[model samples]
Target: MKGMASYSSSHGRLAMAGNLALFCLILELASVGLAHADELRVGYYSSSCPSVEDVVRNTVTNAVARDPGMPAALIRLHFHDCFVRGCDASVLLDSTPGNPAEKDSPTNNPSLNGFDVIDEAKSTLESQCPQVVSCADIVAFAARESVRIAGGFYYPVPAGRRDGLVSKESEVNQNLPMAFFNVKQLEDNFARKGFSLEDMVTLSGAHTIGDSHCSAFSNRLYNFKNTTNASDPSMDQTYVSDLKSKCPAPGSGQDPTVSLDPVTPRTLDNQYYVNVKSHRGLLSSDQALMNRADTARMVLANINSGSMWLHKFADAMVRMGKIEVLTGTQGQIRKSCRIIN
Candidate 1:
């Protein structure tokens, strides 16, 4: 096969056949053909759902244009989905009478939006292709399109994931990382998900675009580590004051939100690393990346090289999309994304 990707910059260019193969092999992506039958492939829907890419692109483009935050929501929605049930769209499932779903978990609740986007895309695919495209694949592809719109980093999403049948609120916390995790905790969390220290740091750079409720980080502002009225010393004092103005102390009133990336909250870029380096990162987890030598090295690399980080981020996303995914006959293609069909 011909080279599948290339990148060029004032720094240099990499378009050779050997480079592409090495990168793909490293990423464990695009294992084409039935030989890797259950594995995902870049063009799995070439004949089955020929319009898959365009349909998702149109749907997400309109949504993001309407709401600038939609890109973050979609990107996070994909991450949350993959973390829990391996990109099976379990996060899209609605809560039944007795069983709550992952979406309602405190880690996710009220913040994880973009279900409508997935439903809308699935609705279109069902009408046109019908039962062929899985909700899991839709979530995965929608996430890739979302990244393209927000960061201009285009990555191929290998499809063929099947929707999962189970989504438990109980299972969420064990699988997902928390906001207050230190470097060791963060490394261990991603390691459990088959990600390296570099992968964890690269993926965390997605925080460049999102918003976080004050409730998520109030610990750092007031009563940090049982010290009343003391903010986290690692957090820049000016940024802390700015955050306090927006998010009143706990019990003050409604929980307002602040952008994850104060500099460019609408665009996915290396500004996240920039914030961490300045001690202005929003979440403790964001700020924590700079606490250690190895992770901090990764952060510095992202800070100095935006284009190269984009390439790494896309590669990480592709690897993430393959996590414990259900394909072939392992799971069903849900007729409606919200319910098991």
Candidate 2:
């Protein structure tokens, strides 16, 4: 059998030979496939969804104006969507009577917001272009808009992703990096998505403007070790005292939230790394960056060099938006983002 391949900057100019049997086998084994770099390009919607950028920008801008936290929420929404089902917008699926979707997963549930914003964008697109736009692309675009609105670096988002059909609750935990993940676990989780250690640390900077529920980090604040009444030793005592007030006690309130970077909670800057350097990273996973020599180096470098960090982060986000995307008839563009057609 003969197989053809092409090169593109985003996909690193990959070419395959032989029957292409090996490639298919690998994708099947991993349960995910990389998007053909040529399939998605910077101006993919120039003709199809010409107004996509304006529509998304206006929608996100208005939403952010009403609630400043919306940008961070949109950014995290994109992350959760890509992590679960390969940037297919599966995270937007609503739970049906018999089949609970990713949105209902405990890992996601109340923590992941911005669904209404996405739904609104999809609705506007449908009104203008009908089925021309994909929920997956809207998500990627919204994330870029979110960062730009948050005073962070801006980068182009390649388009042409299609909405995925599957959204199982069970798959969420298997793919997402957990709040309690140790350094190795953190590295492994991102590695599965074809991300590097640097990508993990740089992308983790998104925590700069977001907040976490008390339950996400309550374990670190109380009975951290196996011993009773023990707290995580790596955390600063003063920070722990502040967290304790917000969190109160274990099982007290799961929904009360605290900023990931209390110093600059509303800004997307190097303060997140600065907090990690000070032993003030909110989640165990955030603190875990300091535990590894390699990640620790990245954390400090990001702190000392703001411009470099912003550039690396923008590059990383672009790479992330390409994960296992569907194109050229691989998946469908749903009329409504919350349900499969």
Candidate 3:
């Protein structure tokens, strides 16, 4: 309890609520019609790898301590992995000869940076519980732990996911939503994965903590559909000016990074809703939430309610983690997260 107090003080207004509130928020998520498959269970590692959670927690904690941005990267890693091959950790594999992996994809290469941390956890797990914990489950658990480390609500991450044997660069674009996608595109993408449109909006809130490259959004700033205005009319003019100063028109030979949430960008919370509502979302895909009345309403709800969005976010994550997961004997538990074993 005292340690949590120390963390709360150090993090400073992340989630902007106490641990008790976060706990209650997660409790409320269960009754909110959120659902996932029965294949994975919270205690999946209770007998096979009892220390799985602790090992991962320690690995992620140490990594974040060294690099505060690691939490966001870990969460992003989870998202990328799940979107492609159902949280099977196919995204973590290195590209082989004539077989480029997901990590090498232009959308992922030079952007994703939490593989070492996952490897560290996998290595420790292999020593203590070899061939027991799967890399897929490790990625899922790391994201859950990252949310807590970044001062968001703690959610239960069901385990039992098996590491996938396949990873392809070609699969990245089809599976992951693009930065230039419209609301309809995003809706269909998450919908095909069995997520409601509201869940799509909720999951987009993960953008609240991470940083994005200028390349991802320069089109919105410089050339939005070849319109007479030369920029997205929906975006706030002041924010556009600020972004232009940092991004420098895209062809200046530099790809500087900007925080996804200018307000408490390092912290995981509902401020992403605040940013989108204010028309300051970094990506067109993110700001597109306001394009539809239905999606906009969910954003407002997330901002107005006290940690209700965070609660719903946990629920969304649970469902997202189960996206076509391979369990039981479906896949092998890779000895190394970077290669099939």
Candidate 4:
């Protein structure tokens, strides 16, 4: 009987040991999860710039105040990066040791490293935040800032994005929607990434602040017959004539320049819609929205009133942040925001 009691006592002690071990394992897991959550929150908050957008807005407002001739180059840079890959800073990194002149010179057509603005902004943020913010979030913040600087609305930006570790020129060529795409082509491209027709129109509102080179959309202006001219009848004659005067001959790829938004050419207002309403859209894709009965009405409604358009634009941007993003172990934390292997 004593022997039996001894065995039972030993079993009891073993069971108690197992429970304690299980409890300790659970506690350790909880601690790790809490740490991870904290890290994610840090990443999210660092990306937002509560005061940065206002600073950018003031810069653009001051530029216009001083000189209306201030080029929309900065606005163009912001739009180009955001549209291609959901505003990842991959567009700004000069990972390769190429010529610095080639990097900054807008005249260098084949290779344009226009990420100087991105670098400057990142440097500024790093000085203040230091390894807390992600470049992806910074791009979004900068876009709104650029708009505000150009006298546009201050759209709400959602944070919590990480910098991408890869930037493929080939990918940009494939993914970035061209200025010459037809309405259907543009629709398919945006839809592939889960954007609706309304989203497309509102996002294109970005044109309100940027300028495009003749080379970018010369196909539409000069070679209308060779490309999608069926929808060409919808464009504003005055605007098209202006484009023709600038582009003149096909394949010239020279001398033409067009503002995405003619009315508020340098401002980030709802004027792109106003342009479309007046049939003054610069691109076939822009006019295509109005050419269609359904999209045209929506454009008219949104343009006439600013509140709805702003809300939709903000929502679409938030949805964009949730795309097939690379985070955690999927992508590396790129030391340099611009270049990636």
Candidate 5:
């Protein structure tokens, strides 16, 4: 009798432990499912808004054709939107009576554009499927199409992202990477958004297409830090001379603008990496990629290979599009992208 009782007690203990372990495993799996519950998937709109992508693609194609610079502008708009509030289309919101929005931020105000393209796409989408799609998704779709139009290949963008209601100007400064950031700072900024060093190097390749205002990098072309009159010593001398011709000294005139990738300013390609390797990077933050060995290796890899950077850039953009997305009824889909619904 005593032996039988002891065996029963031991079996009971083992059973409880097994049950506890199994419960923990279940909890872990559940948490993971909840975490990715809103995972964006390609063809998300196939059933609901089958013609949505077509509308957005045509809109972006027309816009980019009108102004070749529009592709970069659209990409920048998406980047700005994602970084601050996780690709929520908050950047598109205009200031309200009681609340200021992200679009009003100094960092975004002058730099970000291409709102018209998004609005046009949204109007078309609404005509086809009213309130079924989101402005956030529209922004993402436009961005992907813009990349395709700009010489970068088209990669599928997972949709289902909803628009965010809040858009604080103050949040932009803390979130967006600055043009003057060093390699470490750039890495940290991307890291906060769940990006790797390689991802950082890859997305920076977007600079391959587009022009930046002279004010963004005037310091790199003129008396850098008031310590030298010849501009940033790290820059290639010839490139510096060329930039000086385009930008001139600050007070001489209104802030001018220069192409980010002089070799192929209007083309989206791996040439940006080549420029980075040659120290022709327009932004100090761009040149800073070479300050670290790991990123420098990525820069070299991108420069050495053709089409490789484009593939990497597309992958990085997809990853970036997933940052802090609002889905599963988390946020409302705004009727007009500029105002919360």
Candidate 6:
């Protein structure tokens, strides 16, 4: 009888253990499901029922089609915001009227003035989609639209990001890649954000669609005269003459600039690679990719073949959008899309 009791006690303990393990498994699944539900909530507000991404893309494309000149400014704004804090839509705020140093101040970037675009897009999206979508998703979708309008292809954009309340002009100054960056500086900046050298080259294909303000690279065009130290032999004489006509001096407060793709200035095509191959790239940083042995092969491959460039560009954009994404309370829903608070 004692032996029977012992066996029964052991069986009861084992049954309890199995029940506990099953309960734990159910709890784990619930936690995961709750996390995913939170992500979806963070993506869209409860009041509205439309996809903000759709609204943003449509609005931006329409805006650009109405004013083709807006694509360059839009691209600049997108890059400035993304490079600063992972594209949180902080850069789209118009927080300060007079203080140009404020991160959310449109005055800081008089040339781009992204708030105007954001305002128009928001007003339209609100009218169409109502209160259903978040501004953070709008910004991401707008970035992709801006890039596409500038003559690039689309990549998968993972949605559900929230806007950040803070914008830092200083951060923009610190993070933006200069026209004079060597291959190493470019590689390091990209590497910090989990991108490889190949990704750097592929993403730089954005140069194919926009124009650089001569002010941004006067040092390369007018100041770099010494043949041994600062010469850029790749510049086209006609293009340089045109630039000089617009911007006569290095500090002349001029906007003289060259197109990344002189042939197809408005199309997002492989022309940027072709320009690099011919040594007509506008920025030293762009030309450097062609000069470096490490990245030169990739540059040549893209320039020599169209399909290869498109495939890599698409892949790199996907990789870029995935960098350090903010999901699960990493950020907040901005009542105002522009300001972090």
lDDT of each: 0.89, 0.88, 0.88, 0.59, 0.87, 0.66
> For model 4, how does the per-residue alpha-carbon lDDT over 205-287 read when each residue is reduced to its tens digit?
76765666666556555546666432256666677777777665654545556666766676656788888788877766776
Compose the digit string of candidate 3's lDDT tens values, residues 33-77.
133346689899898789999999999999999999998999899
lDDT by residue for model 6 over 185-297, one digit each (tens)? 99998886667888888888878776666676555556476543343457776666655666556545556555666788877677887777777777889888877887988
Count of clashes, each model: 0, 0, 1, 4, 1, 5
Off-target runs (Cα >4 Å) in candidate 4 are 1-43, 46-87, 95-114, 226-232, 251-253, 328-332
Candidates' TM-scores?
A: 0.89, 0.90, 0.87, 0.69, 0.88, 0.76
Report clash pairs, candidate 6.
48-132, 151-268, 164-340, 165-340, 165-341
Cα RMSD (Å) between model 2 and the true structure?
8.1
Cα displacement (angstroms), candidate 1, residue 275, comes to 0.5
- Estimate, for each residue in 33-89, the C-alpha lDDT of model 2 and write its tens digit: 543545788888899779998999999999999888998899899999988878899
- Give candidates' CA RMSD values in order: 12.5, 8.1, 16.4, 12.2, 7.1, 10.8
Residue 127 in model 5: shift from native, Å? 1.6
**Model 3, residue 33: displacement in angstroms?**
19
Off by over 4 Å in 2: 1-24, 27-35
- Candidate 2's displacement at residue 73, Å, is 0.8
Better of 4 and 5 by TM-score: 5
Where is the poorest 10-residue window by lDDT in model 3?
Answer: 29-38
Model 1 Cα lDDT, one tens digit per residue, 308-334: 999999999988888778888877999
**Where does the lowest 10-residue lDDT sum fall in candidate 6?**
99-108
- 2 against 6, candidate with superior TM-score: 2
Candidate 5 structure quality by residue, lDDT tens digits, 32-65: 5446535778999899889999999999989987
- Model 5: what TM-score? 0.88
